[model samples]
Target: MQRKFACFGGSFDPPHFGHLRIIESVLNAKEIDKLFLVPNFLNPFKSHFYFSPKLRLEWLRILCKESLKVWADKIEILDYEVRQNAPIPTYQTLQFIQQTYSLTPKDKMYLLVGADNVESLHKWQNFDWLQNNVEFVIIPRKGFRIPQNFQTLPFCAMDISSTQIRNKLACSDFVELSRLIPQPILELILKEINCKKIDKK
Candidate 1:
Protein backbone atom coordinates (compact mmCIF):
# COMPACT_ATOMS: atom_id res chain seq x y z
CA MET A 1 0.00 0.00 0.00
CA GLN A 2 1.15 3.52 -0.67
CA ARG A 3 2.00 5.36 2.55
CA LYS A 4 0.85 8.93 3.14
CA PHE A 5 3.28 11.26 4.96
CA ALA A 6 2.69 14.68 6.50
CA CYS A 7 5.66 17.02 6.88
CA PHE A 8 5.32 19.37 9.88
CA GLY A 9 8.27 21.70 10.23
CA GLY A 10 8.70 24.44 12.81
CA SER A 11 10.92 26.00 15.47
CA PHE A 12 9.17 24.05 18.22
CA ASP A 13 11.09 26.25 20.66
CA PRO A 14 9.64 24.30 23.55
CA PRO A 15 7.11 22.00 21.86
CA HIS A 16 3.88 22.83 23.68
CA PHE A 17 0.51 21.05 23.95
CA GLY A 18 -0.79 23.13 21.04
CA HIS A 19 1.80 21.52 18.74
CA LEU A 20 0.94 18.02 19.96
CA ARG A 21 -2.79 18.70 19.68
CA ILE A 22 -2.45 19.73 16.06
CA ILE A 23 -0.42 16.58 15.31
CA GLU A 24 -3.02 14.41 16.99
CA SER A 25 -5.88 16.08 15.12
CA VAL A 26 -4.08 15.60 11.81
CA LEU A 27 -3.50 11.91 12.49
CA ASN A 28 -7.11 11.38 13.56
CA ALA A 29 -8.46 13.08 10.44
CA LYS A 30 -6.09 11.80 7.75
CA GLU A 31 -4.85 8.43 6.53
CA ILE A 32 -1.30 9.50 7.32
CA ASP A 33 1.14 6.64 7.77
CA LYS A 34 3.75 8.85 9.39
CA LEU A 35 3.91 12.44 10.53
CA PHE A 36 7.47 13.76 10.31
CA LEU A 37 8.11 16.68 12.67
CA VAL A 38 11.06 18.56 11.24
CA PRO A 39 12.61 21.19 13.53
CA ASN A 40 14.43 23.87 11.60
CA PHE A 41 17.86 25.03 12.80
CA LEU A 42 16.97 28.50 11.66
CA ASN A 43 13.77 29.55 9.98
CA PRO A 44 14.74 31.85 7.11
CA PHE A 45 12.43 34.61 8.32
CA LYS A 46 13.02 34.33 12.08
CA SER A 47 16.15 35.85 13.58
CA HIS A 48 16.81 33.39 16.42
CA PHE A 49 15.17 30.99 18.84
CA TYR A 50 14.62 31.14 22.63
CA PHE A 51 16.35 27.77 22.96
CA SER A 52 19.32 26.35 21.06
CA PRO A 53 18.78 24.03 18.10
CA LYS A 54 20.16 21.09 20.08
CA LEU A 55 17.82 21.81 22.98
CA ARG A 56 14.84 22.23 20.64
CA LEU A 57 15.67 18.89 18.99
CA GLU A 58 15.78 17.23 22.41
CA TRP A 59 12.39 18.77 23.25
CA LEU A 60 10.95 17.39 20.01
CA ARG A 61 12.23 13.92 20.89
CA ILE A 62 10.57 14.19 24.29
CA LEU A 63 7.32 15.32 22.62
CA CYS A 64 7.32 12.33 20.29
CA LYS A 65 7.91 10.00 23.22
CA GLU A 66 5.04 11.48 25.26
CA SER A 67 2.78 11.68 22.19
CA LEU A 68 3.13 7.96 21.50
CA LYS A 69 1.82 7.21 25.00
CA VAL A 70 -1.32 9.15 24.03
CA TRP A 71 -1.42 9.17 20.21
CA ALA A 72 0.03 5.67 19.64
CA ASP A 73 0.97 5.93 15.96
CA LYS A 74 3.71 6.96 13.55
CA ILE A 75 5.12 10.25 14.89
CA GLU A 76 8.68 10.49 13.65
CA ILE A 77 10.72 13.53 14.68
CA LEU A 78 13.40 14.12 12.06
CA ASP A 79 16.55 16.33 12.19
CA TYR A 80 16.86 16.61 8.42
CA GLU A 81 16.52 20.40 8.43
CA VAL A 82 18.40 21.12 11.69
CA ARG A 83 21.42 19.14 10.49
CA GLN A 84 21.86 21.57 7.66
CA ASN A 85 24.24 24.54 8.29
CA ALA A 86 22.28 26.98 6.16
CA PRO A 87 18.60 27.84 6.46
CA ILE A 88 16.89 25.68 3.87
CA PRO A 89 13.71 26.85 2.22
CA THR A 90 10.44 24.93 2.52
CA TYR A 91 10.42 23.77 -1.12
CA GLN A 92 13.98 22.43 -0.81
CA THR A 93 13.14 20.62 2.42
CA LEU A 94 10.12 18.96 0.79
CA GLN A 95 12.20 18.07 -2.25
CA PHE A 96 14.94 16.47 -0.13
CA ILE A 97 12.40 14.34 1.72
CA GLN A 98 10.72 13.29 -1.52
CA GLN A 99 14.07 12.22 -2.97
CA THR A 100 15.49 10.66 0.21
CA TYR A 101 12.37 8.61 0.90
CA SER A 102 12.17 7.52 -2.76
CA LEU A 103 8.52 8.51 -2.85
CA THR A 104 6.62 6.66 -5.53
CA PRO A 105 3.74 8.01 -7.59
CA LYS A 106 1.29 6.08 -5.44
CA ASP A 107 2.57 7.66 -2.23
CA LYS A 108 1.25 11.02 -1.05
CA MET A 109 3.05 13.89 0.69
CA TYR A 110 1.37 16.85 2.38
CA LEU A 111 2.96 19.86 4.03
CA LEU A 112 1.32 20.70 7.36
CA VAL A 113 1.23 24.46 7.88
CA GLY A 114 -0.61 27.03 9.95
CA ALA A 115 -3.41 29.11 8.40
CA ASP A 116 -1.14 32.14 8.80
CA ASN A 117 1.42 30.60 6.49
CA VAL A 118 -1.15 30.15 3.76
CA GLU A 119 -1.65 33.92 3.59
CA SER A 120 2.11 34.46 3.06
CA LEU A 121 2.78 31.39 0.90
CA HIS A 122 3.82 33.64 -1.94
CA LYS A 123 6.74 34.94 0.14
CA TRP A 124 8.32 31.53 0.55
CA GLN A 125 11.13 30.35 -1.65
CA ASN A 126 9.92 28.92 -4.94
CA PHE A 127 6.31 29.52 -3.94
CA ASP A 128 5.05 28.52 -7.37
CA TRP A 129 7.00 25.28 -7.28
CA LEU A 130 5.80 24.46 -3.79
CA GLN A 131 2.19 25.11 -4.73
CA ASN A 132 2.49 22.79 -7.72
CA ASN A 133 4.18 20.03 -5.74
CA VAL A 134 2.70 18.77 -2.48
CA GLU A 135 -0.71 19.37 -0.94
CA PHE A 136 -1.03 21.38 2.30
CA VAL A 137 -2.72 20.45 5.57
CA ILE A 138 -3.67 23.81 7.01
CA ILE A 139 -4.19 24.12 10.78
CA PRO A 140 -6.19 27.14 11.90
CA ARG A 141 -4.57 29.65 14.21
CA LYS A 142 -6.26 32.11 16.60
CA GLY A 143 -5.86 35.29 14.58
CA PHE A 144 -5.60 33.68 11.17
CA ARG A 145 -8.58 32.29 9.32
CA ILE A 146 -8.31 29.48 6.81
CA PRO A 147 -8.25 30.60 3.22
CA GLN A 148 -11.33 29.97 1.08
CA ASN A 149 -9.53 28.21 -1.76
CA PHE A 150 -7.32 25.92 0.38
CA GLN A 151 -8.12 22.58 1.95
CA THR A 152 -7.74 22.47 5.76
CA LEU A 153 -7.63 19.78 8.38
CA PRO A 154 -10.22 19.65 11.13
CA PHE A 155 -8.28 21.35 13.94
CA CYS A 156 -9.37 22.83 17.26
CA ALA A 157 -8.11 26.36 17.03
CA MET A 158 -5.24 26.91 19.48
CA ASP A 159 -4.36 30.40 20.69
CA ILE A 160 -1.03 29.26 22.13
CA SER A 161 2.24 30.67 20.89
CA SER A 162 5.85 29.70 21.55
CA THR A 163 6.66 33.32 22.29
CA GLN A 164 4.04 33.42 25.03
CA ILE A 165 5.40 30.23 26.58
CA ARG A 166 8.93 31.62 26.52
CA ASN A 167 7.78 34.80 28.17
CA LYS A 168 5.93 32.91 30.88
CA LEU A 169 9.01 30.81 31.54
CA ALA A 170 11.21 33.87 31.73
CA CYS A 171 8.86 35.35 34.33
CA SER A 172 8.57 31.98 36.15
CA ASP A 173 4.83 31.75 35.64
CA PHE A 174 4.22 28.07 36.28
CA VAL A 175 0.44 28.45 36.46
CA GLU A 176 0.19 29.55 32.86
CA LEU A 177 2.82 26.94 32.01
CA SER A 178 0.61 24.19 33.43
CA ARG A 179 -2.23 25.27 31.17
CA LEU A 180 -0.34 25.76 27.90
CA ILE A 181 2.46 23.15 27.86
CA PRO A 182 2.93 19.45 28.45
CA GLN A 183 4.71 18.38 31.62
CA PRO A 184 7.79 16.90 30.01
CA ILE A 185 8.35 19.84 27.68
CA LEU A 186 7.66 22.26 30.53
CA GLU A 187 10.33 20.59 32.64
CA LEU A 188 12.79 20.85 29.78
CA ILE A 189 12.05 24.53 29.33
CA LEU A 190 12.47 25.26 33.04
CA LYS A 191 15.71 23.30 33.16
CA GLU A 192 17.19 25.17 30.20
CA ILE A 193 16.01 28.58 31.39
CA ASN A 194 17.33 27.94 34.90
CA CYS A 195 20.66 26.79 33.54
CA LYS A 196 20.94 29.93 31.43
CA LYS A 197 20.16 32.07 34.50
CA ILE A 198 22.78 30.27 36.57
CA ASP A 199 25.32 30.72 33.81
CA LYS A 200 24.65 34.44 33.76
CA LYS A 201 24.97 34.76 37.55
Candidate 2:
Protein backbone atom coordinates (compact mmCIF):
# COMPACT_ATOMS: atom_id res chain seq x y z
CA MET A 1 0.00 0.00 0.00
CA GLN A 2 1.25 3.53 -0.76
CA ARG A 3 1.73 5.64 2.34
CA LYS A 4 1.27 9.38 2.49
CA PHE A 5 4.26 11.52 3.49
CA ALA A 6 4.88 15.21 4.06
CA CYS A 7 8.10 17.22 4.36
CA PHE A 8 8.46 20.30 6.55
CA GLY A 9 11.84 21.88 5.92
CA GLY A 10 13.25 24.89 7.73
CA SER A 11 16.10 26.34 9.74
CA PHE A 12 14.35 25.63 13.07
CA ASP A 13 17.09 27.89 14.50
CA PRO A 14 15.42 27.48 17.85
CA PRO A 15 12.27 25.45 17.69
CA HIS A 16 9.59 27.60 19.30
CA PHE A 17 5.88 27.29 20.06
CA GLY A 18 5.10 28.49 16.55
CA HIS A 19 7.08 25.57 15.21
CA LEU A 20 5.33 23.29 17.66
CA ARG A 21 1.98 24.48 16.35
CA ILE A 22 2.92 23.60 12.79
CA ILE A 23 4.42 20.28 13.80
CA GLU A 24 1.28 19.30 15.66
CA SER A 25 -0.92 20.64 12.91
CA VAL A 26 0.73 18.54 10.21
CA LEU A 27 1.04 15.35 12.21
CA ASN A 28 -2.55 15.50 13.35
CA ALA A 29 -3.70 16.21 9.85
CA LYS A 30 -5.58 13.38 8.16
CA GLU A 31 -4.01 14.19 4.81
CA ILE A 32 -0.59 13.14 6.01
CA ASP A 33 0.60 9.76 7.27
CA LYS A 34 4.12 10.77 8.36
CA LEU A 35 6.39 13.83 8.39
CA PHE A 36 10.04 14.41 7.58
CA LEU A 37 11.87 17.27 9.29
CA VAL A 38 14.51 18.42 6.83
CA PRO A 39 16.70 20.92 8.61
CA ASN A 40 18.82 22.86 6.16
CA PHE A 41 22.62 23.15 6.40
CA LEU A 42 21.82 26.76 5.63
CA ASN A 43 19.01 28.38 3.71
CA PRO A 44 20.11 29.55 0.29
CA PHE A 45 18.49 32.91 0.93
CA LYS A 46 20.40 33.34 4.21
CA SER A 47 24.12 33.57 4.89
CA HIS A 48 24.58 32.04 8.37
CA PHE A 49 22.99 29.89 11.04
CA TYR A 50 23.17 30.70 14.78
CA PHE A 51 23.25 27.00 15.64
CA SER A 52 25.08 24.28 13.74
CA PRO A 53 23.11 21.67 11.74
CA LYS A 54 24.07 18.97 14.23
CA LEU A 55 22.72 20.96 17.17
CA ARG A 56 19.56 21.96 15.34
CA LEU A 57 18.86 18.35 14.35
CA GLU A 58 19.55 17.19 17.89
CA TRP A 59 17.24 19.80 19.33
CA LEU A 60 14.51 18.84 16.85
CA ARG A 61 14.69 15.20 17.92
CA ILE A 62 14.60 16.34 21.55
CA LEU A 63 11.57 18.43 20.71
CA CYS A 64 9.76 15.46 19.18
CA LYS A 65 10.55 13.15 22.09
CA GLU A 66 10.08 15.53 25.01
CA SER A 67 7.25 17.67 23.73
CA LEU A 68 5.57 15.81 20.90
CA LYS A 69 6.01 12.28 22.29
CA VAL A 70 6.66 11.14 18.73
CA TRP A 71 8.68 8.14 17.63
CA ALA A 72 10.64 7.17 14.50
CA ASP A 73 7.48 5.97 12.73
CA LYS A 74 5.71 9.26 13.27
CA ILE A 75 8.51 11.66 12.46
CA GLU A 76 12.01 11.46 10.96
CA ILE A 77 14.81 14.01 11.15
CA LEU A 78 16.50 13.81 7.73
CA ASP A 79 19.99 15.32 7.35
CA TYR A 80 20.29 15.00 3.57
CA GLU A 81 21.39 18.59 2.94
CA VAL A 82 23.05 18.96 6.31
CA ARG A 83 25.18 15.91 5.53
CA GLN A 84 26.23 17.60 2.29
CA ASN A 85 27.18 20.68 4.38
CA ALA A 86 25.94 23.16 1.81
CA PRO A 87 22.94 25.29 1.14
CA ILE A 88 21.10 22.88 -1.15
CA PRO A 89 18.08 24.13 -3.02
CA THR A 90 14.59 22.87 -2.14
CA TYR A 91 14.19 21.47 -5.65
CA GLN A 92 17.11 19.14 -5.14
CA THR A 93 15.83 18.20 -1.72
CA LEU A 94 12.46 17.20 -3.17
CA GLN A 95 14.11 15.21 -5.92
CA PHE A 96 16.15 13.36 -3.33
CA ILE A 97 12.96 12.62 -1.38
CA GLN A 98 11.11 11.53 -4.49
CA GLN A 99 13.83 9.16 -5.51
CA THR A 100 14.52 7.98 -1.95
CA TYR A 101 10.91 6.98 -1.31
CA SER A 102 10.27 5.72 -4.86
CA LEU A 103 7.52 8.30 -5.24
CA THR A 104 5.86 8.49 -8.60
CA PRO A 105 3.98 11.30 -10.31
CA LYS A 106 0.75 10.02 -8.78
CA ASP A 107 2.31 9.86 -5.32
CA LYS A 108 2.91 13.63 -5.10
CA MET A 109 4.94 14.60 -2.03
CA TYR A 110 3.18 17.13 0.17
CA LEU A 111 5.53 20.13 0.49
CA LEU A 112 4.95 22.39 3.49
CA VAL A 113 5.86 26.06 3.28
CA GLY A 114 5.08 29.21 5.25
CA ALA A 115 3.09 32.09 3.82
CA ASP A 116 6.27 34.18 3.70
CA ASN A 117 7.67 31.79 1.08
CA VAL A 118 4.60 32.09 -1.16
CA GLU A 119 5.53 35.33 -2.95
CA SER A 120 9.03 34.22 -3.81
CA LEU A 121 8.07 30.56 -4.35
CA HIS A 122 8.07 30.96 -8.09
CA LYS A 123 11.61 32.26 -7.91
CA TRP A 124 12.89 29.17 -6.07
CA GLN A 125 15.24 26.98 -8.05
CA ASN A 126 13.30 24.70 -10.38
CA PHE A 127 9.91 25.96 -9.25
CA ASP A 128 8.31 24.27 -12.22
CA TRP A 129 9.38 20.85 -10.98
CA LEU A 130 7.94 21.62 -7.55
CA GLN A 131 4.56 22.64 -8.98
CA ASN A 132 4.28 19.33 -10.76
CA ASN A 133 5.78 17.05 -8.12
CA VAL A 134 4.23 18.20 -4.83
CA GLU A 135 1.13 19.60 -3.26
CA PHE A 136 1.79 22.90 -1.45
CA VAL A 137 0.45 22.99 2.11
CA ILE A 138 0.49 26.65 3.10
CA ILE A 139 0.96 27.48 6.77
CA PRO A 140 -0.69 30.85 7.16
CA ARG A 141 1.16 33.99 8.23
CA LYS A 142 -0.28 37.26 9.55
CA GLY A 143 0.08 39.49 6.47
CA PHE A 144 0.43 37.15 3.54
CA ARG A 145 -2.47 35.95 1.43
CA ILE A 146 -2.60 32.28 0.50
CA PRO A 147 -3.29 31.76 -3.15
CA GLN A 148 -6.36 29.75 -4.11
CA ASN A 149 -4.19 27.20 -5.84
CA PHE A 150 -2.56 26.16 -2.56
CA GLN A 151 -3.97 24.05 0.27
CA THR A 152 -4.05 25.76 3.70
CA LEU A 153 -3.50 24.34 7.13
CA PRO A 154 -5.54 25.83 9.97
CA PHE A 155 -3.35 28.09 12.12
CA CYS A 156 -4.27 31.03 14.35
CA ALA A 157 -2.22 34.12 13.67
CA MET A 158 0.83 34.10 15.94
CA ASP A 159 3.36 36.83 15.26
CA ILE A 160 6.33 34.58 15.92
CA SER A 161 9.20 33.46 13.74
CA SER A 162 12.71 31.99 14.17
CA THR A 163 14.23 35.33 13.19
CA GLN A 164 12.20 37.16 15.86
CA ILE A 165 13.36 34.70 18.51
CA ARG A 166 17.06 35.18 17.63
CA ASN A 167 16.81 38.97 17.73
CA LYS A 168 15.01 38.84 21.10
CA LEU A 169 17.68 36.62 22.66
CA ALA A 170 20.24 39.42 23.16
CA CYS A 171 17.90 42.29 24.01
CA SER A 172 14.71 40.59 25.14
CA ASP A 173 13.99 38.56 28.25
CA PHE A 174 13.42 34.78 28.49
CA VAL A 175 10.20 35.28 30.44
CA GLU A 176 8.63 36.20 27.10
CA LEU A 177 11.00 33.91 25.28
CA SER A 178 9.97 31.01 27.49
CA ARG A 179 6.38 31.39 26.31
CA LEU A 180 7.37 31.53 22.63
CA ILE A 181 9.64 28.47 22.71
CA PRO A 182 8.72 24.97 23.83
CA GLN A 183 9.69 24.28 27.45
CA PRO A 184 11.99 21.36 26.60
CA ILE A 185 13.82 23.34 23.91
CA LEU A 186 13.86 26.43 26.10
CA GLU A 187 15.49 24.49 28.91
CA LEU A 188 18.22 23.28 26.57
CA ILE A 189 18.72 26.81 25.24
CA LEU A 190 19.09 28.15 28.76
CA LYS A 191 21.63 25.46 29.64
CA GLU A 192 23.62 25.53 26.39
CA ILE A 193 23.55 29.29 25.96
CA ASN A 194 23.94 30.02 29.69
CA CYS A 195 20.86 32.25 29.89
CA LYS A 196 18.55 33.05 32.77
CA LYS A 197 14.88 32.17 33.18
CA ILE A 198 12.10 32.32 35.76
CA ASP A 199 9.48 29.70 36.43
CA LYS A 200 6.01 31.13 35.91
CA LYS A 201 4.41 31.66 39.32
Candidate 3:
Protein backbone atom coordinates (compact mmCIF):
# COMPACT_ATOMS: atom_id res chain seq x y z
CA MET A 1 0.00 0.00 0.00
CA GLN A 2 1.22 3.48 -0.88
CA ARG A 3 1.98 5.59 2.15
CA LYS A 4 -0.13 8.71 2.60
CA PHE A 5 1.70 11.84 3.74
CA ALA A 6 0.83 15.23 5.17
CA CYS A 7 3.10 18.21 4.44
CA PHE A 8 3.43 20.97 7.02
CA GLY A 9 5.59 23.83 5.78
CA GLY A 10 6.73 26.94 7.59
CA SER A 11 9.86 28.97 8.31
CA PHE A 12 10.05 27.43 11.80
CA ASP A 13 12.46 30.19 12.83
CA PRO A 14 12.35 28.47 16.21
CA PRO A 15 10.45 25.27 16.62
CA HIS A 16 8.04 25.88 19.48
CA PHE A 17 5.91 23.63 21.66
CA GLY A 18 2.81 24.34 19.59
CA HIS A 19 4.38 22.90 16.44
CA LEU A 20 5.42 19.75 18.28
CA ARG A 21 1.92 19.40 19.73
CA ILE A 22 0.35 19.62 16.29
CA ILE A 23 2.69 17.00 14.89
CA GLU A 24 2.01 14.67 17.80
CA SER A 25 -1.73 15.18 17.50
CA VAL A 26 -1.71 14.54 13.78
CA LEU A 27 0.38 11.42 14.12
CA ASN A 28 -1.68 10.01 16.99
CA ALA A 29 -4.86 10.63 15.06
CA LYS A 30 -3.47 8.36 12.36
CA GLU A 31 -4.70 10.74 9.72
CA ILE A 32 -1.65 10.13 7.55
CA ASP A 33 0.97 7.44 7.35
CA LYS A 34 3.76 9.99 7.36
CA LEU A 35 4.16 13.71 8.05
CA PHE A 36 6.67 15.96 6.30
CA LEU A 37 7.83 18.87 8.44
CA VAL A 38 8.88 21.22 5.64
CA PRO A 39 10.80 24.29 6.69
CA ASN A 40 10.90 26.97 3.99
CA PHE A 41 14.26 28.23 2.75
CA LEU A 42 12.74 31.68 2.47
CA ASN A 43 9.12 32.43 2.97
CA PRO A 44 7.78 34.89 0.38
CA PHE A 45 5.16 36.45 2.60
CA LYS A 46 7.30 36.58 5.72
CA SER A 47 10.58 37.22 3.91
CA HIS A 48 11.32 40.26 6.05
CA PHE A 49 11.27 38.10 9.19
CA TYR A 50 12.92 34.69 9.32
CA PHE A 51 15.99 32.87 10.50
CA SER A 52 18.59 31.41 8.18
CA PRO A 53 17.50 28.16 6.53
CA LYS A 54 20.44 26.36 8.07
CA LEU A 55 19.48 27.39 11.59
CA ARG A 56 15.84 26.55 11.02
CA LEU A 57 16.79 23.11 9.67
CA GLU A 58 19.01 22.50 12.69
CA TRP A 59 16.19 23.38 15.06
CA LEU A 60 13.84 21.07 13.20
CA ARG A 61 16.29 18.22 13.42
CA ILE A 62 16.46 18.67 17.17
CA LEU A 63 12.68 18.78 17.45
CA CYS A 64 12.38 15.59 15.41
CA LYS A 65 14.86 13.85 17.66
CA GLU A 66 12.78 14.83 20.66
CA SER A 67 9.47 13.82 19.11
CA LEU A 68 8.16 10.38 20.00
CA LYS A 69 6.67 9.92 16.56
CA VAL A 70 9.13 8.32 14.16
CA TRP A 71 7.04 8.74 11.00
CA ALA A 72 7.68 12.46 10.59
CA ASP A 73 10.02 12.99 7.61
CA LYS A 74 12.36 15.96 7.10
CA ILE A 75 12.16 15.69 3.30
CA GLU A 76 10.98 19.26 2.96
CA ILE A 77 14.27 20.63 4.27
CA LEU A 78 15.99 18.82 1.38
CA ASP A 79 13.44 20.11 -1.14
CA TYR A 80 14.07 22.55 -3.96
CA GLU A 81 12.77 25.45 -1.87
CA VAL A 82 15.89 25.21 0.29
CA ARG A 83 18.16 24.82 -2.76
CA GLN A 84 16.77 27.75 -4.78
CA ASN A 85 17.83 31.24 -3.81
CA ALA A 86 14.44 32.63 -4.89
CA PRO A 87 11.17 32.17 -3.06
CA ILE A 88 9.51 28.83 -3.77
CA PRO A 89 5.77 28.80 -4.32
CA THR A 90 3.76 26.32 -2.23
CA TYR A 91 2.07 24.82 -5.27
CA GLN A 92 5.44 24.13 -6.83
CA THR A 93 6.56 22.29 -3.71
CA LEU A 94 3.41 20.18 -3.71
CA GLN A 95 3.91 19.29 -7.37
CA PHE A 96 7.48 18.22 -6.78
CA ILE A 97 6.48 16.05 -3.80
CA GLN A 98 3.71 14.46 -5.82
CA GLN A 99 6.06 13.48 -8.61
CA THR A 100 8.99 12.54 -6.39
CA TYR A 101 6.96 10.39 -4.03
CA SER A 102 4.80 8.90 -6.79
CA LEU A 103 1.62 9.94 -5.02
CA THR A 104 -1.48 8.66 -6.82
CA PRO A 105 -5.08 9.78 -6.83
CA LYS A 106 -5.84 7.11 -4.28
CA ASP A 107 -2.92 8.15 -2.11
CA LYS A 108 -3.77 11.21 -0.06
CA MET A 109 -1.49 14.22 0.30
CA TYR A 110 -2.70 16.74 2.85
CA LEU A 111 -1.34 20.27 3.24
CA LEU A 112 -1.38 20.85 6.98
CA VAL A 113 -1.91 24.45 8.01
CA GLY A 114 -3.16 26.52 10.90
CA ALA A 115 -6.72 27.90 11.08
CA ASP A 116 -5.44 31.45 10.47
CA ASN A 117 -4.00 30.40 7.11
CA VAL A 118 -7.21 28.55 6.30
CA GLU A 119 -9.17 31.81 6.57
CA SER A 120 -6.66 33.50 4.28
CA LEU A 121 -6.39 30.60 1.86
CA HIS A 122 -7.74 32.66 -1.03
CA LYS A 123 -4.83 35.06 -0.73
CA TRP A 124 -2.19 32.34 -1.11
CA GLN A 125 -0.29 32.07 -4.38
CA ASN A 126 -1.89 29.61 -6.81
CA PHE A 127 -4.66 28.95 -4.31
CA ASP A 128 -6.72 27.21 -6.94
CA TRP A 129 -3.87 24.87 -7.76
CA LEU A 130 -3.47 23.99 -4.09
CA GLN A 131 -7.15 23.28 -3.70
CA ASN A 132 -7.05 20.99 -6.73
CA ASN A 133 -3.89 19.12 -5.84
CA VAL A 134 -3.89 18.53 -2.07
CA GLU A 135 -6.32 18.19 0.80
CA PHE A 136 -5.83 20.27 3.97
CA VAL A 137 -5.49 19.54 7.68
CA ILE A 138 -6.05 22.71 9.65
CA ILE A 139 -5.10 23.21 13.30
CA PRO A 140 -7.10 25.86 15.08
CA ARG A 141 -5.40 29.08 16.08
CA LYS A 142 -6.53 31.49 18.76
CA GLY A 143 -9.28 33.85 17.53
CA PHE A 144 -9.38 32.28 14.05
CA ARG A 145 -12.56 30.86 12.63
CA ILE A 146 -12.92 27.89 10.32
CA PRO A 147 -13.66 28.74 6.72
CA GLN A 148 -16.87 27.66 5.04
CA ASN A 149 -15.51 25.66 2.12
CA PHE A 150 -12.82 23.73 3.93
CA GLN A 151 -13.54 20.78 6.17
CA THR A 152 -12.12 21.30 9.64
CA LEU A 153 -10.50 18.39 11.42
CA PRO A 154 -10.57 17.79 15.14
CA PHE A 155 -7.31 19.35 16.34
CA CYS A 156 -6.27 21.17 19.47
CA ALA A 157 -6.07 24.96 19.39
CA MET A 158 -2.41 25.53 20.24
CA ASP A 159 -1.84 29.03 21.53
CA ILE A 160 1.95 29.02 21.34
CA SER A 161 3.89 30.37 18.35
CA SER A 162 7.50 30.72 17.23
CA THR A 163 7.23 34.51 17.43
CA GLN A 164 6.11 34.35 21.05
CA ILE A 165 8.87 31.90 21.90
CA ARG A 166 11.47 34.13 20.28
CA ASN A 167 10.19 37.13 22.16
CA LYS A 168 10.47 35.21 25.42
CA LEU A 169 13.98 34.11 24.57
CA ALA A 170 14.94 37.72 23.80
CA CYS A 171 13.88 38.65 27.33
CA SER A 172 15.62 35.56 28.78
CA ASP A 173 12.28 34.14 29.90
CA PHE A 174 12.45 30.69 28.34
CA VAL A 175 10.70 29.05 31.29
CA GLU A 176 7.24 29.10 29.66
CA LEU A 177 8.72 28.01 26.35
CA SER A 178 10.67 25.25 28.07
CA ARG A 179 7.39 23.71 29.18
CA LEU A 180 6.21 23.73 25.58
CA ILE A 181 9.16 22.21 23.69
CA PRO A 182 10.84 18.92 24.42
CA GLN A 183 13.85 19.12 26.73
CA PRO A 184 16.27 18.24 23.92
CA ILE A 185 14.96 20.95 21.58
CA LEU A 186 14.74 23.48 24.37
CA GLU A 187 18.39 22.87 25.23
CA LEU A 188 19.37 23.33 21.60
CA ILE A 189 17.47 26.63 21.37
CA LEU A 190 19.15 27.87 24.52
CA LYS A 191 22.55 26.89 23.19
CA GLU A 192 21.94 28.63 19.87
CA ILE A 193 20.71 31.78 21.58
CA ASN A 194 23.73 31.90 23.89
CA CYS A 195 26.12 31.35 20.96
CA LYS A 196 24.55 34.27 19.08
CA LYS A 197 24.87 36.53 22.13
CA ILE A 198 28.51 35.61 22.55
CA ASP A 199 29.18 36.34 18.89
CA LYS A 200 27.49 39.73 19.20
CA LYS A 201 29.81 40.64 22.09
Top model number, TM-score: 1
Note the Cα lDDT for every prediction shown: 0.84, 0.83, 0.75
Report the error of model 2 at residue 174, Å: 1.5
lDDT of 1 by residue, 9-97 (tens): 99998789888888888888998887888999988988877788888899888877876665556777778888886678988888888
Model 2, span 23-139: residue lDDT tens: 888877745666888999999999999878888988888888877775457788789989999999998988888788787665647888999999999899999988877889999
Q: Using lDDT as the measure, name the better of candidate 2 and candidate 3.
A: 2
Candidate 3 total steric clashes: 0
The candidate, 2 or 3, that scores higher on TM-score is 2
- What would the TM-score be for candidate 1 when compared with the true structure? 0.94
In model 3, the runs with Cα more than 4 Å from the true position are: 1-3, 69-79
Clashing pairs in 2: none
Model 1 lDDT on a 0 to 1 scale: 0.84
Residue 91's lDDT in candidate 1: 88
Best by lDDT: 1
Evaluated against the true structure, the overall lDDT of model 2 is: 0.83
